[model samples]
Target: MSIEAIGAIGAVEAVEPAALGVPAAPVAAPGFADWIAREVGQVDATLATSENDLRRLATGQVQNLHEVMIHMEEAKLSFQLLAQVRNRLLDAYQEVMRMQV
Candidate 1:
């Protein structure tokens, strides 16, 4: 499954202000920390699910080995993406620290 699919699985509905008889207000975007935390949580959950699938396969509980392998690959890819994001964030922080105010 793709990132969009994962996001769709956890999608939340937006509530309109008019429906609640309230005035619309500016909504603050999520901070980088919050975004990163959420991503990390998703990656963790993916890894855990993949691991469970693997265990099930090992115990002869799972009928399809291909599905287990796919889950493993998905977990691996998500981890790599998270690691790259972390590296980029660290590099940006270091660059900012080196600059003179």
Candidate 2:
């Protein structure tokens, strides 16, 4: 249920004091592309762990069925959340394209 990847939502770029003739400082925080890559990597890892647990269950190596089910559910939810975010971003991009400039 934790969506730490969405923590990039409020990141702002560093601005320069152009009026004072000062150059802009480099941003220290990770960018949107990095965040997306990290989030996708997390989702992939979750899914892989769930798949491994399922395989272990099939091989009769898993003792707790509940824990395996929980992992599966976690993976499912993570993927769903990622999908929703992608859909929203796509919708926004399409809307922007349709706007008359």
Candidate 3:
């Protein structure tokens, strides 16, 4: 399924930065921006579903606490993955800036 479909299934809402009155950063390329946006959307959807599952478990709507714990761990792993990616990007930018012209 596409990112949008997954988001819809998870009932995740998209918030535009501009709509929130935040200035948008200029993307180096449209395709790159779209790819990043899709990944972010997927992460957001997963986190939302994980949170909902925890809520359900807390309210006794769900029987298995293990499932909620698994989802929470998955979200944590995804967040770590995103953090690594960000770190790598920052390192690359720093390397480029330090290059002798």
Please give the distance, in angstroms, between residue 99's alpha carbon in candidate 1 and its true position after superposition: 0.4
Query: What shift in Å separates residue 80 of candidate 3 from its native position after superposition?
Result: 0.6
Q: Over the stretch 1-101, how does candidate 1's per-residue lDDT look in tens digits?
A: 68888889667688788888997787899998898899999999999999999999989999999999999999999999999988998999999999998
For model 3, residues 3-101, the per-residue Cα lDDT tens digits are: 888778668578899999999998766686688788888888889999999889889999888899999999988888878988998999999999999
Q: Residue 55 error for model 2, in Å?
A: 0.1
lDDT of each: 0.93, 0.94, 0.87
Worst 10 residues of 2 by lDDT: 1-10
How many Å off is the CA of 98 in candidate 3? 1.0
Pairs that collide, model 2:
none
How well does candidate 1 score on lDDT at residue 61? 100
Residue 4 in model 2: shift from native, Å? 60
Top model number, lDDT: 2
TM-score (all chains, Cα) for each model: 0.73, 0.73, 0.67
Supply the TM-score for candidate 2.
Answer: 0.73
